[model samples]
Each structure stands twice: as C-alpha cells, then as structure tokens.
Target: MRCPSRARRTRALLSALIVSVFAVFCGGEIASAQQEPSAPQPVSAVQLQSAIAKLGDLDYSARTNASRLVRRTPAAQAVPALIQAVSEHGDGYVRYRALVLLSGFNDPRAKDSMRESLTSPNDRLRAVAYSFFEHNPDRALIPQFVTAFDTEQGEFVRPAVARALAAAAAGDGVEVAAARQALIRDVARGEDFFRSSVIEALGDYKAAFALDAITSVAKLDGPLQDDAALALGKIGDKRALETLAAIQRTASRQTQPSIAAAICLLGVNCSSHESYLVETLKFTDRNAGYQELLRAAATGLGALGVAGHQEAAASLFDVGIPATEDSTRAPVALAVATIALRSTRLMMTLLEQYADREKAVALLAEGFDMLEEDLDKERFFAVARRTYWESDGASPRRVLMQTLIGTLDF
Candidate 1:
C-alpha cells in the first residue's frame, strides 16, 4: 500500500536523522549525579514558561531529551503549548513528547483538550490525547468518553474512549453500577473488543461490585478470557489468585504465560504461583504466549531479586532472540529483555531503535521499572540491539557483543 511505502521512506529518513543528530546534539548527556551549581543560567521561570508557550513548531533540532527541559519550566505554560501541538503538529514524535510533557501537569483546560482528543477523527492524535488522560484524574468527562465509544467511526479512537471511560468509572465513581452493568451486558453478548477495553480500564479497582463481574467475564468464551485474566492481575488481590491458578492450570502453554503474568502482578506477592513462571519456562510454544512467559519470568525474576532471577531472565532472553517466525515475537523479547535488565544500562540500549506498528515493528515498556531515569539509554540500546540483530552479520550489536565477551573473558 501507498501508506506503507511512505512510512518506510519516513523511517529511513528519521533513522538517518537520529544518527547525524546524535553527535551534534546528544554528545553532551545530562548527568544524573547531583551537583551544586556555580551560577544559574539567564532564563527565568517566567521567561522559560513564556518560551515554552510561544514555540510554534516542534524543536526537532534539540536533543532527544529536549522535552524534559521544557517540562521542568512550568505546567501552566506547558499545557497550552502541548494542547496546541495536539491540535496542529505534523510530526507524531513531537506530538507524542508534548503529550508526555503534559501528562505531568494538572491543568483543567487539559481535560477539555483530552476530551476533544478522545473524539478526534485522527486515530494517532486520539492516541496521544488518551495517553495523557490515562494518569491524573479527569472525572467529569466520563459521559463524553462513553458516548464517543458508541458513536465514533474511528476504530482506534473508540477504544481510547472506552478506556478513558473505564478509568473514569474507576476513579470518579459516577454511576459506577450502571457503567458496570453496561460493560457486563456487552461482555455477555460477546462484544469482546469493547469488553476487553472496559476491563483494562478497571485496573487496580478492588471494589466488590466489579471483581465478581470481572471474574465471571474471565470464565466466558473468546478473548474476554485474556482480558479478564489481565485485569485480575492488575487488581493484585489475593481473591483472584485461585482463579488465576486454575486458569494457569487449564490454559494452553501459549495462554499460560499471560495468565502467569496476570497472576504474578495481581496475585498476592511472590506467595501464590511464583513458581508458575519457572515451571513453564522449560516449554517452547513459539507463539505470543512464549514471549509473554519470558516477560512474566523477567518480572518475577526482577521481583525475586536473587542471583537465580538474573540467570533465569538471561537464559530466557537468549532463547527469545534469533527472532521467532511470528513478528509479534520481537516485542515479546523486548519486554522480557526489559524485565531482565531492569535498572541496568542493558535496557537503555534496547529502546533506541524501537518503532511501533508500521512495517518491521519493535515494542517497548515505557514505565517498566523506573525506565525514565535512563530513558534515552533504553532507547539507544533498543535501537542498537534491533539494528544489530536484524542486519547482515556485521552490525553494531554483533560488534558490541564481541567486545563485551572479550572484556568479560579478560
């Protein structure tokens, strides 16, 4: 399709741009080490906020971390600029960062913009808007979000509304029973897509009203099973443990990984089925579930915080690589690698070349275990690893791996 061709050219252009810009822009990295400043820069808080508000175009010339400096200025000023970017920007990356910056702020206007974005005809724009609204409460807009779900023609945008409404239902407590009933009705009739989004929206909600409903939905046929299973994992209540354990017992090896991950996250600590991950790793299903188990294993390993944890994650990472036949395996490996390398520089390199959706895709975890501290590092390594793994025999990752092995040997 014409769209694919355009995206290929854009990615090629962007990759070239990243390499050329890195030396000129990123050579001076931000040091996390605390230091007492000798003198302050000339920019005042007011002036800085003004500059952030006035900048009409995306500063593509700035380093990859430019958005952080912009965010640190002031939310009152930054929110308006970000709202404008969502309304007008041409570049998806720029719009994405602006929204990321907006996520930290608590301006009332942002809620309106977010509401509008939820209903935006543009799918990508709607995605950006929902990303910000996900965190930080915006309760009054639940009705708006719910309406968008049934009326909107944009396939991508409708899900965001469902999620936003679901989050609102969890946070705002407005007509919660009615909302629960509506979602339950949909689930009963086999509206798996809407039901999944609704369950996902109810993350961390321990209310008795929803728990029984979610559990019952999990028992249903079709994809809602996975959705309910994932939601139960997010709730992290002990009540779901037995259900998850049963699910893990009966689930195909492919489905078991997700069930395990859900259980690990939602089940009571490392107590319930902690060994579920370890027991399953020995099998090789090669579907998305195989990757899910690796991810769940990495999470469990990270949580276990023992020598064996690292060993288990590393071994799983090795098996996951060499890229499985199904392209979905790439993101699966990336997530597992992320869990395996949490808090280490190993993850920093993995996220660099990460791209989403079009053509060859790479998946990443934005909030997986304190990734923000070393976000650029994660991006750099992601790019470096994927580029190395995908190219001919000679590439950055292979050469780097060789150097690392030699050093370890020495």
Candidate 2:
C-alpha cells in the first residue's frame, strides 16, 4: 500500500505549490518585491519532478498543502499521489485528509484505495475512511463500511458512519434494515457521537423510526440525553410528541432545557407545558445560564408552536447570568436571550434583570460597542434596561467590554 518514490514526490511538489500560493496571498504587500532578490532563481519542472520523487523533503506542512489541492482540483492525476501520502505517510491526520480528497475521485482505482484504508491499522485513519464512506453512502461499500462502523473505537468515526448508514438505509440498499438497527443501538447506549449523528441523519432521511431512537436517548444519561432531546425536536414525527411529553414530565431539571430547546427548534405547536417552563425556572436553583439546557428549552418551546412561548423568554430574566468562564457564558447568554426575546413578555423580563444585576448589568450596556448586529444590540440593551448601571470607577465600563468580546467566537 506504500506509495512509490515518484508518486510521493508529486505529493511534495503539490504541497510546496500550496505553501507558496498561501504566502503570496496572505503577505501580498510584503511579497510585492521590486525584483526577485535582483536575481533569477533556477528551478525547473524537470528538477521539481526529480525533487518530488523523494519523500524525505516532505513534512506535515507539505502534506497539508497536498490534501487541500486534492479537495479542490479536478485532476484525477493527483489521486495516486494523495493515496500514497495517506496510506504510507506519517500520522493519521494526513491520512484522513487524503481519504477525504479520495472520495471526490470517480475512478474505481482511487475508490478501491480508499476502501482499503477503511481497514487501516490506525484508528484515526479508519475514522477518516469511514467519514468518506458515510458522506457518500454507497450501498456497494456498506459491507466494508460496516466492518469499520461496528468495531471502530474512535467516536469521531462512529458519527459519520451512523450518518452514512442512515443516509444509505432509505435507498434500495442491502443493509437498509441493518442501518436502522445500528441507529437504535447507538442511541440506546447514549453514545454521544453516534446518538447525535443518528438523530441528525434521521432528519436527513425523514426516518420516523429514528424518533424512537431520540426518545430512547432522552431516557439515557449524559450528552445523548441532551442530543436525543434535540433530535426529537428536529425530527418532528408527532408520534414522538407523546414520548416527548412523558420525558418532559419525569426527566430532571437538567434535562428540561434541552427538551424545551428541541420543541422550539422543531416548530411543533404541542407545548401545553408553557406554564411548566415558567414554573421550572422558579424552582431550579441554577443561577448561571445553562446553555445546552436553555437551548433545549427555548428550541423545544419554539417547536411547541405556541405563540405564548413568549413566556419562556419572560422567564429567562432577560438579564443573563454569565458563566464565570467567559468561554461557556457568552454564547449561552446570547442564544437564550435571543430565544426569550421572541416574546415581548420575556424581553421585558430580560430587560428588568439587566437593570437588576449591577456588574452583569454594566456589561450589557457597553455590549453594543463590540457587538455588530442589531439583534445583539437589542439583547444587550434589554439587559442594560433591566439592571441598574452604577459606574464604580474608570475600569467598570472597561471590565464590561472585556467580557462582551472574545478573541474569537466560542
């Protein structure tokens, strides 16, 4: 399976081209030289072909370049080079990139090479291999795809395989039933990656049976419960609505947010529990914004198709309690506030809370300087209006601006 010297070098050359191109694009002002060091360099295609023949000069940077080209280009000629780089190269990440690129090629030769990598001794490589298979959902490869699907320990791979299987199952595939069963198995176990992937795939396939899987996970613990709750909302097979109602009743307060989020996201109008959402916030001692929790709740309430969902927002206290950890806090604050603001009642509550909490209050006041959207400006203003802005010192406003933004969107 190792690539030949010639092919290996081609991959390296491809890598060099990519780096050069990126440098040229990124540092255009700097690279705009009056002359090339006032002298012409001597590099020819024949020498490049020879230099590329050797893999010794290739490194991860080069491999990265090769992978990107494989994804974008129409050249079938690059397939063999990429296949060798992935199969015989250093590290599974590089191999994974190669597999992704290989999927684009229509030739059986490359497809066969990709299939062979499905059994890569390295689990990372196997994970990438399955991703390609899942993305394609080719029935002819299901048996081979399944081998990796079942035994692969990599959570990363499982989601993609489940997705591919779910995608493929609805078609005239040999393993349509098996794919359905696998979806059940993953959801039932509360496996985080598989559960979400299956639920999402069900959305793509419109698999009503998949709702059972979502319901099953709603019963499990940890992330799947969260995922299952979201999936149920996404699927919107009304048959599961009764199950959703049941789960809403018995599930922990921790689970409520997800359930609410799911209902909201699905746009289903079945939420008789609108009062319950209002009631739930009062009882729960959770002070900080629970993101997954709020998302599940707001999204589910949205799904309930109830106009009164404005109540859920009113219950949100408009003034968001930011998590001490800015990473976790900001996104949750924005999302829940956005969902809650859908209702004027909720928006009023949020505005009131902003007026109430002093430090958190000040943060919302200055949020607009950093925030671009009118929606964010509105959310922050709602918080600012609810909480009193007491200026403590010069840094009071500065402290607020610091949390309002991050180096990047989390």
Candidate 3:
C-alpha cells in the first residue's frame, strides 16, 4: 500500500491519545467501545434543594413537577433536606407536599420529623403528620400516638390522631390491652369521628380479647354496625362468625351485601348465598347499582374460596374475561384468581375453553396481581408454566405462556 496520507496519520494519533487518556482515568480497564456510557450520578443534595425550592413556584405545573422530582430523590440523602423543608422552609401546602414525599421513604429519621410536626402551630401540618402515621403505622409508636390523641386539642387533628393511634395499635408487639382500652374509651366518649377507624384497627390487630366489645358495637344500628360487623369478620373468631351470621340473617337490603361479604371473608359457611353471588355475575345491564353488586358478590365468592364451585368460575369467566368495563372486569378477574389459587386445574380449564387466549391470559394476570403472599404468587406462576408447557407451545395458548413468562420476570 502507498504511504498513509498525513491526515490519516494524524487521526490515528488522536484516537490512540484519547484511548490512553480514558484508560488512565478509568482504572486502566478499557471500556467497551460499543457500549453506551453510564449515566451521570445524580447530584442528590443540589437536586433536593432545587426541587424543594420549586414547591412554592406560582405555576401549578412547576410545583407538581418539583413535587415529583423531590419524590424521586435518593431517600438516604433526601430525608434530611425534606425534613428541613417541611419544618422550616415551606408554606402550608409546600410543607404538606414535602411531608407527603417524606412518607414514601422508610427512614427512622422521618418519624422524628413527623412527631415534631404534630406540635407545629399549623393545623394542616399536624393533620398531614397524623395522616402519615395513620397509613405508615409503627408498633413502637403506639404509645406516642395514644398520648397525642389524648392531648390533641384541635378538632381537625383529633380524628387524624385517632386514626394514627388505631393503626399503631394494630401492629404486632403493641400493648394490645392498653391500645384497646384507649380506643374503647374514645368510642365510649361518643366521638363518632374515629369510631369506625378504631373498630377497623381492632379487627386488624386481631384483638381477640376485644371480641366482646367489638360484638357490642356490631349490634348497634347504623353505619357503625356495618363497620363493627366487618371488624368482627376480620377478627375471624368463632363468636365473630356467629355475630356476622346473625347480622346477615337480619340485615336490611341496604346492609345485607356488606354483612354477607364479611361472612364470606371470615371463611364462614356461605354456601347458602353462593347461588345469589353467581346470579349477580349474570346481570348484563351494566347499571351502576348492578355493577356495585357484581363487584361485591364476586369479591365475596373469592374470599369464600372458589375451588369446587365450577358454576361460579364459569360465571366469572363469562363476565370477567370479556369485560370491557373496568369496574366489572377488576372484581371478576380478582374472583377468578382467588378461585384459581385454590384450584389451578379450574383456571387451566377456563383458559382452554376460551377462544381468545390473549384476553384470558391478561385476565388471569390481573387476578395473579391481586395475590399478596409470595408463596401463592409462586404457585400461580408454576400453574401457568405447566399450562404453557402442556399446550406444547400451541397458538393462542403459546401467546398466553409468553405473556405470563414476561410478566413474571417483571
């Protein structure tokens, strides 16, 4: 070949120089030339400060964008700055937004900030703090919440405090007796504001010791009665089941569905009502009232365990798989999943019968998503895999299997 041109030689020299510089800076390991460069590390502190500052921007869009950005910050570095923003820098709405973002982080430091907010002169801040504790309850904070509820003078904050106390009390390792006494005292004080929440917490804690008290509430007429009945169902004690049955037997049309649902969820004998549940799925009018009934009945059937009820499964598949409406589709899919968990064979049968495998798989996926226990989820996945393999990668079924495999990884 002829001697390389001067331009080519110069280009070669510059390329070698760049590679050497890169190797020197990057610990002498030559990076892959084909690979894309890594993204720049977020300047956590600067980003946090900038986002906090934008919370007060006059434009609503700017404020919302800032809130979103602040929420995306690294929790480890953002907690301190967010606490400062909530405590010192922001107006009522800004502080509220900051506190909301702070709640997403599972940092112990955020607790102290929340506790401090309880004493702030601003009612809105106090309310937000209580709401945080309500949804993110801690077992260790039960006493503090109880004490706060007693001393909190503002009417607006009292309900929030009660809700927080209930949530905290529901946690394991809580002083159950003391928490129950506190809740009962408030209930007896006749403040209806937090009575339902307290009942819910009592059930959540499975405070079997409070069965008698909860039953007493369940006997009362009105909204509290329904709350108490649901709480009793959640408690799942023999007495609670009997109490729910009693409510179901005597409840008016308006209240019967809820009590029935409670009974089903408690794993009580709901065989007598199974027919009605199946019937609820058959209504095709799509009226709002019928939709609500469909959802409640479908969910109740799932809670009752749909393993042997081929009829129920058929009804759910008929309504749910083809359901274009979200309201009807969600409940029906959930019911199907619940049943499938108990009997994977039934789900496979339904899948085999349905002409549209993609829609069927999507529906099953929705149901699978509702499962909370890891073991149950894994079992569902195993069943789906078996179905996939048994079909020998056939069309329609193959599509379902592929979608299921993809979703499982996610």
Q: Which candidate leads the pack in lDDT? A: 3
Considering summed lDDT, which 10 consecutive residues are worst modelled in model 1? 1-10
By TM-score, the best candidate is 3
Rank candidates by TM-score, best first: 3, 1, 2
lDDT of each: 0.46, 0.47, 0.60
Poorly placed runs, candidate 3 (over 4 Å):
1-41, 44-47, 56-60, 131-143, 151-159, 170-176, 188-193, 270-410
Error of 2 at 276 (Å): 13
Q: How many backbone clashes does candidate 2 have?
A: 43
Model 1 lDDT per residue over 94-119, tens place: 55455545544556776666656665
For model 1, the stretches where C-alpha displacement exceeds 4 angstroms are 1-69, 72-80, 83-97, 105-109, 171-174, 189-194, 220-222, 236-249, 261-272, 282-410
Higher-lDDT candidate among 2 and 3? 3
TM-score list, all predictions: 0.54, 0.51, 0.58
Greater-lDDT candidate between 1 and 2: 2
> What lDDT does candidate 3 reach at residue 392?
49
> What TM-score does candidate 3 reach?
0.58
lDDT of 1: 0.46
